[model samples]
Target: MEEERLSQQLHEYALWKADVARNLGLYQNFLESQDNEDNELILRIEDIIESLSTDRIVIAFVAEFSRGKTELINAIFFADYKRRLLPSDVGRTTMCPTELLYDHVSKESYIRLLPIETRLEDTSIAEHKRNLDYWTTLPLQVESPDKMVEAFKEVVKVKRVSLEEAKRLGLFIEDMAQHLEQVPEYVEVPMWRHALISFPHPLLKGGLVILDTPGLNALGTEPELTVDMLPNAHAVIFVLGADTGVTKTDMDMWQEHVKVFSSGGKKGLLVALNKIDTMWDELENSETVASKIKGQCVSTAKTLGIDVATVFPISAHKGLLGKVKHEAALLERSGLPKLERVLSDEILPQKQRIVRDRVINGIGATIKMSRDSVKRNYDGTRQQLDELQSLDVKNNSMIAHLLQMTRKETIIYETRVENFQTSRALLMKHVKEMQEFLNITELDKHITAIRKQMEGSWTTGGMKKGMTQFFEQIRYNMTQVSYTASKANESMQSIYKRFHEDFGLVDIKPSILSMHHYDMRMDNLAKRAEEYRDSTAMTVSEQSFVIKKFFISIVSHARDIFAKAFQEVENWSKSSLVPIAVQLKDSKTALQRRIDNLQRIRDSKETVEGRIDELNQSLADFEARLKQLNEVCDAIHKPLSFDQPPAEAEDIKQQTAS
Candidate 1:
């Protein structure tokens, strides 16, 4: 039952996300009703809502071959099927990296596989995903476990190819060839490079994604897996064999692929010492067996150089069998419940915090600005109503003087608008300068040059030097961009302060462009490059393979960093002045409306009583909208509760079955 906690937390997280999306929709509708012309704000809200709708919490399972990574996935997520959903028997069952997620967009269950031959192309896997023609598709019959199993067999399929072809695909290694007494003309390689399975499992439908990766060879050849996918996962479960403890290949995978994530305080990195049943001796007592498992876990932690608490000893084999047979005691003995509890308790809350922070920072600030604008308009209207009500129509001199005063106020507002336009021009100039520093086209030029240099190099050392210089140039560019961003921020702050002092305007601090994270990301990538350069494994590998991996993993990631910085700069440029502009426009419109009403009163064309009545109705409308806006804000800020008891796993299974 404790294993159900992960499912329960995922359910609650889904509900919470829906609630936030609903509130965002309400806010978007409110904005549309109030000001249809503020399309920028409306579009921003739409983007946030779209992201919430499609977001997935990705958990990647990484390990060397025969580590039970796939078996663990089947036990934890697919136990309700009463059988193995993924191929997990014997050696090298899953030859390629596989992804399991619900197809929220298509609402169809299917398996998509990318042919291994596509690796010969320059296009990345991410690019291939966008164009379905590159992948072979198969319909998945989720209702029939046997059919699903048969379809999943394609992931483990392999084909014999000439050794030359395998080498060209970057699948051949000299070390692997050296193992043979005689050089073979042909070698077997995975038929597919990647597998994506979309089915309507409850957890998958609740926005959970499971990434099952193959061994080190696959990780080394497929650079995107290490550079992009693993790093982006919400949590990474590195499965280790309890029978072998931490092997050399496992340690290599950890240090080269997974250890960098640990530097971020190891919050989302977890170790699963799988196949603990290997140490389950019939002659030993339960306490003795558990002690051995615990000792192995500690040893694994020591070898991996991580805290022992992060290492969990589990038997994926028994866990799957227990769940299928409905034997709770067997499952308990498998040590799955404790691991599940920690995963649910730690990962879900951390994910929630990340989503909460993004929503608060993005939509929350915009809503506050909108509310302030509405409040200002309401207050200004009330003041105008009070002033109008004080006037006596019989006193023509008083009405004339009031009309003159309002016209003068209109002139002052017009003057302020002109001054704001000049200041805006200066701001735009600074924004242009900032944009120059973040120009993607310029970054592309740098990338092109670096690629040429690396390609022209004859030796591994020369290419490694080129790789180092590539990152150095990128780092230098980011530093320049950061400096320019700071300058632009200063100009924006000055503009806000001037308006606040000269005319009564709200002093809204502009959104800062923080490049520190990107800077740190580049630094990490550089560090990874250095490690790769110094790697004995890479030294033994082909120079061509090394170059391809460097570009795919390191250079591509650096390019992405620059792209994101460019996008952020553009967004900041557009939104930084929106609030003040909205307020000023509303103020000017209010002033004009007052002048028109008072002039009519002075000309004896419209009654003072009539004008007062109109003002009263307008005031009431603003108040009602303001109240609704406040309620929407409250809904957006409301915290989600996760203390409710979880439903039994059997109940969840039945519901999904239905």
Candidate 2:
């Protein structure tokens, strides 16, 4: 909900910024007024928001000249995969970024390559299917976002190959040998630089996202995709070298930017502190090194005006299994869930807040404008002006009604954003804490206990009996663990719901503000009609002389009376508060009619967040319980090698008592 909201705000602000820029250009030519930097800053905020919204992460194995970017990607995303998105080597591996999306159906699956020069009107594709010679070098193109996949299939993947054998598919023995054995240079091939690659993955439901970006030379020399695709992805895992934290080039990339014109706004930005294993190897004290690395990340986040929670430390290369820690007993996969949760929960909610803020700001602007206009109308009454100026700066008074509204609205806007941010921060912090609490250290302790128990069980029960009992205990534990997971999941949903409601989310009763406003409007309209009827009705041909000559005068009198009435009310109320009060009252009535239409935006956001939180908790508990349930099943059915029946019973007793 928050992410959707932030995206909405960023988009709105982005559009507003673009419109402002367009107007600025026109005004420069026609009005010849000097441009205000302050105004430009406001517009830039919107533009920044837009940039954030459109960002699809493209992490170019960015390094100086050649620092093994392609090698890293190949190792990370494609080592186990059946198909290679792009042929990689020590040099010139990726001439183009092979963007991989998912395409479920499309019998004749083929590769589509789109050149950078391909226009919106041009619908062309360079396709190859099963033919290894042609498959590796096809150009892809598409006319619109609508046919992006079709273009990808036509240009990147082989079409209608039907899982043909290597020999039948005419796979070159030499090419296959070259592919298996690393060479100095990647195979020379024609590239559709702008083309995207779409194919199916065996494991993941959404399929795998493998972005084969071009060499640093092309990316730096002509930075198009970098700008275009950064904000598009759910998260960008910027793979920097652990050996070098922030080189001159890295700092430059962070600092120097193109003066790109934005029509939208910027919102979500995340940083990835990658390649920690290299630092771990370099520094003798790995703990000290890791601490320093985390500190550096915090410092970097500060420099970039982003949250540290947005930063992720991922050993993508290590996770790919190219390098495994000998000392480690189990797989260390810390960054995956961190990245997923950051994108899905934290980043998502921030985007939503940005959207809500935009709406509130827009309303505030209207209120401020109305109040400002009213003040200007009655500007220089020395006594009145002096009296009006003497009120609390933060009060909900007419003296600063519009300004106060602006601030109040900003508070309301920030409230949700702040809550989401806080929730995200707390959520991530606790999850990480959970991981740390049940880390390798915890596992090691359990393994140690199990080892001791196993020896005792072997001494007591015969090998056959011990083994059977252990298996039975494992099964019993698993069942109990599953039960615990189910219970925790149920509890979490209620907890998340309470958090959501605390932030002003409650029953779905209709808004009374708008209905009251409508009633007020009807009453006024009826009174006016009755007054008109009491006066006189005359034909156009025989109109009353008084009516004909005094219509404008009558309106003027009524308006003047109303104004005076407001002025008279100023002793108790406020002089500037009239307009905002009118707007609120009017808006209230309109809002009641379309209250549902007013967008329960915050409500929508909280709902998604609450649900996600509940699911995540359930998943965590489910993981823990499954482990226990397996142990229980093993205890009941068969003897286990890991622990004796007494040990299993001890654990189960403690759990059941809790």
Candidate 3:
């Protein structure tokens, strides 16, 4: 029953993520339809849409060897493999850090391994991620678990090497080398740098990523893992053996790799005290064992600088066995339920909240601004129609009023056209400035200068810092572009205000003139620029080729981003007031018709009615589009809910039978 409940929880989470992705697609479609020319906004929306579609909930398992981290992962997510998915025997099973995720694109199961020799180069893992040719791929026999198990053993395969060679590959530390001086060959190292597994498990298919990292040595050697991957994970579950308590290596791992995530005592970290079944033999009763485990949790929490509640006591072996056998009592005793609840209820929702906030801030804000601007235009037009509706054709005063208003509106139109030209020039000026801002010539020069400053020490760490500096400069350029955009928007709004406030002309503020829309786009731009940091999380040792690739890729990406943004600004500056200008032209035509009909008021009543009908049709078209804009806006703000899935008829029958 507990297993079924847990399965239901995972199913609902998957459904919710899928629904979110669906809604994101709808938003992308709406944005594309409206602003096909505005590439910046489209690109921003596309990025968000892509992120939503491929969103993965990464749960990193951090622990020393023999702590049953791999076993716990199997119990929680991979029992459906019907056996251990990872090699988790009595000895160290996971020697290389392995990432298990479903590759929905290929729809095939395989493992990709990076050769350990690559670590001798200066390329970061982030760079290697772009080139699949660098990794060795092994196909899994999905039809037979035994064959799959056999293939999986490659993750733990090791090769013996001389101490000097081992040290060169970052496998041997001086302290360990000193202790191993008596041994001729001091190192037995894993053949792979990293292992990437793609399997068709339901949870993994639902975008659950499992990172099973090797113990202290691997974490210590992999700077990118500590700096980027682990820090960026949604949650890090540090598994500890209950009998061993918090060992020295575990504390070191906690302080160096895990504690950073929980610096401010954040909720994205959890500690699992595994192998609690061992405690049962020492304690007299079940209650006593539970008490002893709780005591261990407290002691371990204090040692790890976390709260006792964060330390969960569980037996992965028992949990997997109990869950497999459908024994509720054993599953309950395993303490897996409490940990699973925390994940489903707290951690998953937190991830959802972060994604929701981004969508609301970026897409939702843009839609609201667009909808409101359209609504304002529609309301103003409807008011003019209403005034025309009530005016009597026989009234000479009405004709005079209409003529005077039309003349003023004509002046407003002329002034707006002139202001638009000025805004266009200003936009062009900013676009040129932005083009310069994103130009890689200066960036390349700066990078060259930094490389010179490094004096050929251009080691991985040196270049990594250089990359960080490079991204910072890119961020600065993006900031300048945003400031220029904001300035242009301010000019547009000022021009709009003169028409409405001074000339008493109809409100002509275009959606493009609205700062809210630009602000949202700029915010998204800044976010994408910030994400470049994540992309740079390449391990320093990959090779200098990675730096060149990263530089070109980043420059090209920047050009696209800024080019799209500048084009949007140009488009807005040129065409923002066009809607109001057209309306003004129509207003003038209507007034001219009214004036011509003034001499023959009673006779030209039919013509006046025709003009009114035209106005009504125009208003109707605007209102319909306005309705669509509002619907899209509503969808953006709508809160997502994942109500429980309805029970199947067979399940209900089985329950009744039981």
Candidate 4:
């Protein structure tokens, strides 16, 4: 029953994610129907929807050798397989950071392994996945579990490598060399860079991505997994053996990699003390066993400098057996229920909220802007219709009043045109200011300074600090460009209002400054910079070169982004005030028409009445559309709850408890 409940929670999460995607698609379709007038808004919403579509809740398991990471995964998610899904035996099993996901499009079960030699190529695993020729494929036979187990063992394949080769591959360190007084002829190295296992597993099929990371050696060698994959996962489960407590390697992993989340204020990191069943038989009293487990949790938490509440003592082996055999007592004593609760209740909800906020904040802003523009158009049309209805062509006093009003309106329109010229000059000045903010010369200087810091006397610690500062400067400048864009938006809006109020300009939509894109670009650059810093495989020289190359590419891309923004601003500034100029011309034509109509009032009365009726009809239609747009905007801004229905996420503690 507990297992079924967990499955139901996953199903609900899938439904919620689908709802988000559907609503975003609806909004994008509505924008597209507007004939691409709001290109900036439409493109941004499209990007958001695309991101949400591919988004999956990735849960990563990290630990040293024989900590039962794979077994834990099997117990929590893959127990329905009825046999060991991944090779988890006495010796080394998982040799690469294996990712398990369901590829629905493929609809076939297989494991694809990338050649270890591919690391020499300058491409990411994500890029490598796109090219099938680079991977070795092993198809799984669903009918035969024994054959599948044998096929899975291919992941642990290794070849002897000379010490020189190992050093060149960034696998050797001083500590290992010191222990090896006699340099061995060769050392066994993983044959694959990465292993991708795709099967129709229940949890995986429900938009869940599981990253089963290998031991320390594999993580130390694979910079991409250490720096990018693990950090970006929705949740990271750091497993430690309860019998051994926190070893030196576990502490190193915590401080060097897992602790990096502290800076981001992320709460998805959890510590699991596995193999607790080993302590079960050490004492006879049930209370004594409970005290010992609590002691281990506290000791492990203190050693790792994490909250004791975040640590869970679990026996994955026992838990797997208990779930498979329906032994509720064994499953309860194994302590897997608490961990699963944290996963379904805590981590999943956080992911949902993050995705929900991103969609609502981005799409809601665009909808509000469009709605406001439409409302302004509606109000302007109504005012025009009212003025036309009030015009009395028979009264001479009314003729005088209309003539005087036309002159006043014309003067105000002419004055607005003059003010727009001044605003255009100011707009040019701001454009130059924004361009200066993104100047590459200053960025190059920053890069040169960082290069010097690394090339000179430097420790790894100092180099890390220098890299952080370098990226900080990059972000600072990028932020300045975004800030200036906002100012430009304000300037354009002021002009929009003057034209609308003084010159009777209507239907002028907000110009697309795209400041949000700038913010997103900066965030991506920061994430990449942090990833590069976390890398453990690269040599000091290699790290330096990689950092420099990354920055250079970012600067180049920054130049292109800023250049496009500048061009758009220039184009928008040129045309933003044209409505006022056009209005002035119309006013002059209307003044001449009024003067002639006074002499032929009898003849022109019917034509004037027809014009008034047309204005009234247009105004009525505009108001109706404006009201519909307002309702759409209201629905978007309405607050949404991210939690699942409590009954569906029902507590399974009683069934799984000891």
lDDT of 4: 0.69
Q: Which window of 10 residues has the lowest lDDT sum in candidate 1?
A: 649-658
Which model is ahead, 1 or 2, in terms of TM-score? 1
Q: Model 3: which ten-residue window has the lowest total lDDT?
A: 532-541
Candidate 2 lDDT tens digits, 396-431: 344244444445654564554555445444434433
Per-residue lDDT tens digits for candidate 4, residues 396-484, read 67767666776676676567668878876776777778777666666567767876876573455766677677767767776787788
Per-residue lDDT over 425-530 for candidate 1, one digit per residue giving the tens place of the 0 to 100 score: 8877866776676677887888788778877885777787778778777777788878887878887887788788767666677788677888888887787677
List, residue by residue over 166-279, the lDDT tens digit for candidate 3. Answer: 767766655554555475665788899999999887777767788999874566566556645776699999999987888877776676557767753567799999999988
Q: List the residue pairs that clash in candidate 4.
A: none
CA lDDT of 595 in candidate 2? 26
Give the winner by TM-score.
1
In candidate 3, stretches whose alpha carbon ends up further than 4 angstroms from where it belongs are 1-39, 181-183, 393-401, 413-445, 452-606, 618-620, 642-658
* C-alpha lDDT values of all predictions: 0.82, 0.37, 0.68, 0.69
Error of 3 at 649 (Å): 23
Top-lDDT candidate index: 1
By lDDT, the better pick of 2 and 3 is: 3
lDDT, candidate 2, at 426: 40
Question: Which has the higher TM-score value, candidate number 2 or candidate number 4?
Answer: 4
> Each model's TM-score?
0.94, 0.32, 0.76, 0.75
- Candidate 1: which stretches are off by over 4 Å? 642-658
